[model samples]
Target: MSKIMSAPTLHHFSSLFTLFIVLLHHSNADVGTASRYSPPYLPSGCYGTEATQFPSSNLFAAAGDGIWDNGAACGRQYLVRCISAEQPRTCIPDQSIQIKIVDYAATAVSPASAGGTTMVLSDKAFGTIANMSATLINIELQQV
Candidate 1:
C-alpha cells in the first residue's frame, strides 16, 4: 500500500522546492558574474587640487595602504565596473569605467566607515556609473 502525503505537507514541500530552484539559479549566475566589493565612498579631499583639473568624464578612486606605494601609485590607473548596489538601486551591468588613483584615504576613513570598500570614487566618477544619490556602491576594481 502507498501512503499519501497530507495537503499541508505537499504545500510545504512545493515551497521548499521553489526556494531551492531560486537559490540554485542565483548560485550559478554568481559564477559568471563578477563579485562586488562594498563600502565605496566619495572623497571630500583629493590631491588638494581643483576638481576641474581632474578628468570629469573618466573615473577616479581613492587608495588606502595601496596608495603608500612611495608615490608610485599616485598616477596608477584602473578599470572600474559597477557590479552591485544597495536597495533602491542596482549596479549598471557590464559598464566599465576607467579611473585613476588621485588621492589617498586613511584606514580610519576607508572600509570601516565606507562599508569595507577599498576604493573611493570621486563624485563625477560615481555619477557616471550610478544613477542614485547614495555615497557608497559596490564595484569591481582592476589595475590597468
Candidate 2:
C-alpha cells in the first residue's frame, strides 16, 4: 500500500479543500434581501444633515425593519456580500462590501427600493457586490 499521494491526487485534494473553505466562509451570516437607493441620501433619520454621516467610499446602507432596532442600528457597520438574485450570475464573484448604516430605509428622504427589503444599500454599495441591472439581491449580512 502506498502512503504518499501522487501529484495529481494531491492537487485535486487541495482544490477540494479550498472549495470547502470558500463555501464555509460565506455561510456564517444572516440571509437577507438587499435593494438599492440613489443619491441625495441626506436628511437621514439618524444623522439629519450631518456631513460626516456618509462615508467617502460611498459604501453605506439603510436598515430595514429586520435590523432597524428602533434607531439603534444607526452607524453600525456591516460586511455584505451578494449571494444570489432573481437572475443567475448577478452576484460578483469574490466580492464583499463593508457598509455603514446611515439611515432607516422606511423613513429615508431619498427614494429607496420597494418595501420589504432587509437593507437598502447606497447605489455605489449595491453595485460593488452585484450587477447594476439587478434591482435586488440576496445578501449575506454580517456585522463586523
Candidate 3:
C-alpha cells in the first residue's frame, strides 16, 4: 500500500509554503525603483557672503583669500557661479554680485536655525546687498 500523509502534516506544509511565497513576493516587489526620500539640498557655485557669514564674527573669510573686514563694502559689482561638486552639471544659479566675497563660515548651527549653509559678511556688505537677516543668502551664480 502507498503511504499517505496526515491531514495536520499537509496543512502545516501548506502554511509554510504560503509564507515562503509571500516573502518571495515581498522581496521581488522592492526591486527596480528607489524608495522615495527628500531630495538633497543641491550645492551651487554662486555662494554669497550673506549666505556664508556669521553675525558674531568680526571679519569675513573668503574661500580663496584671507580674512576681510567685517564692515567693508564692495567697491564694485562682482559675479560668481554656484556649482555643486557632487552634481557638477547641475548649476544652482547664475548671477552677479556688487559685494565682495569675504571671510565667513560655510556652515552654521543655531538653536533657532539648527542647520544650514554659512556665509559671513560685514555689516555694510549685508546692508548694501541684501535685506536678509538670516545668516544665509539666496544667490545666483553665473559662469564668468
Candidate 4:
C-alpha cells in the first residue's frame, strides 16, 4: 500500500539526516582540536629573523590587507618592538606576541620598513596588547 512505501522513505530520510549531523559534529570537533596545536606545515629547523625596520601602516592591517578571510587566525609567535604615539621617533619598548603573517611582500613598506618579511595579527591580538591602530610594533619570528 502507499502508506507502507511512505514509511520506508521516511525512515531512509531520517537515517541520512542523522548521518549528516554526525559528520558535521565530527568535523567541528576536529577543527577545535587542530587549533590548539600548531600546524605541522612549518618545516623543522626553520627560524624567523628579528626585524630591524618597521612599516608605515599598522603592521597588523598591512599584513591582513590582501589575505583571504581565513587570515583571521593566521598569527604565530613573534618578538616585537613596540612604540607609543607619545614617543614616535624612537621605538624603545620590546615585547613578544603571537601574530599571524598575512601578507608576503618582496619589498617592505610602512609603519616600519622591514626588509622582506612582514606579518599581521588578529584584531583581538592586535588591538588588545599592541594597540595596532595608533601604536607601532616590529615583529620577528620566534624559534620553536
Candidate 5:
C-alpha cells in the first residue's frame, strides 16, 4: 500500500522537475543571426537623425524584420554574444555586449546586414564578440 502511494508522488516530482529545466533553459538565451554595419549610423528608421541617437559606447544595432516589431523594438536593449559563424574561429569566446536598437535594418544604408539576419550590429559591437571578417554569425541574445 505504501509503495502505491509513493508512485503518484514520484510522478508529480518528475513533472515538476521537467518544468523547472525548461524554464531554466529559456531564461538563459535565445539564438539568432547577426551581421555587421559600418558608420553613418545616423538617419535611422527609429530616431531619424536625432542628436542623441547613437550611444556613447557605439554598441548599437539595427533590428531585422523578426525583431523590428513594427517600430516597437526601438530603444529596446539586448545582451548579445557571438555563438558561431560560417568562418572558422569567427566567435570571440567569453565576450558579450549590451546593444541598443537604434534603427531598422531594412532602411539602413551601406548594405546594412545580410539578408534574413536577426539584427545588424554596429561595427564596434560586432568586433567585440566576433571576427570583423565574418559577414554573419550566430548569436545568443537575452533582453534586459
Candidate 6:
C-alpha cells in the first residue's frame, strides 16, 4: 500500500521535472538574439551626392565602425537577410538581399539606440528584404 502511494508521487515529480526542463529550453532558444542590432535605412546615403547620383535599385549599406575599421568595408558586399521587422504586420519573412558597402558609419553610430544598430542600409535593400516602411529592422548579415 505505501509502495503504491510512493510510486504515484515519484511519477508526478518526474513529470513536473520534465515539464520544467522543456519550458526552460524553449525560453532560452532566442536568448542572445535580443543583443543583436536591427539596422536602419536611408533613402539616399551620404556616399553619393546630388551631382553624383545613385540608383535606388542598387542595394548598398553603410558599415558601422564596430564592424569595419578605417574604411576597410568599402567595395565589400554582404548577403543580408531581414529576420524580423518592427511592425509585425509589415514583416515579410525570410527575405535575403545582397548589398555592397558603399559608406561608413561614425563610431557614434554604435549604441545608436537602446535596441542597437549594426549598419545603415539603402532604402531599396531595406524595403526589399523587410517589406515594411519601418526605419529599422532586424537583419542577419554575412560577407559575400
TM-score of each: 0.53, 0.80, 0.25, 0.26, 0.82, 0.54
Tens digits of per-residue lDDT, candidate 1, 1-144, equal: 999999999999999999999888732111011212233333323445445535656466565553436445666787776766664665666677887776665532334225334566665666667654555666666666
Stretches of candidate 6 above 4 Å error?
Answer: 1-56, 107-116
User: How far off is residue 121 in model 4, in Å?
Assistant: 1.8
Model 2 misses residue 65 by how many Å? 0.4
Higher-ranked by TM-score: 2 or 5: 5
lDDT of each candidate versus the true structure: 0.56, 0.92, 0.32, 0.34, 0.91, 0.55
Clashes of 3: 25
After superposition, the stretches of candidate 1 with alpha carbons farther than 4 Å from their true spots are 1-53, 56-58, 66-70, 107-116
lDDT (Cα) of model 4: 0.34
Off by over 4 Å in 2: 1-28
Best by TM-score: 5
Ranking by TM-score: 5, 2, 6, 1, 4, 3
Q: Which candidate number has the best lDDT?
A: 2
Off by over 4 Å in 4: 1-95, 100-117
Model 3 TM-score is 0.25
Off by over 4 Å in 5: 1-25
Residue-level lDDT of model 3, residues 1-144, one tens digit each, is 998889999999999999999888732111110001111211312333344432233222222112223424222123432223232333234422333443222321212121233333343433333432333443332212
Q: Over the stretch 1-144, how does candidate 6's per-residue lDDT look in tens digits?
A: 354548889999999999999888732111111122133333223444342333455676666655555767766777777676556855467677677766555432323222335666655666676653476666677777
User: Could you tell me which residue pairs clash in candidate 5?
Assistant: none
lDDT of 5 by residue, 1-144 (tens): 354548889999999999999888746578999999998877899999895988899999999998999999999999999999988899999999999999999998657657788999999999999989889999999889
Give the per-residue lDDT digits (tens) of candidate 4, residues 2-83. 5454888999999999999988873211000000111121221112233322232333322322332344423333333333
Full-model lDDT, candidate 2: 0.92
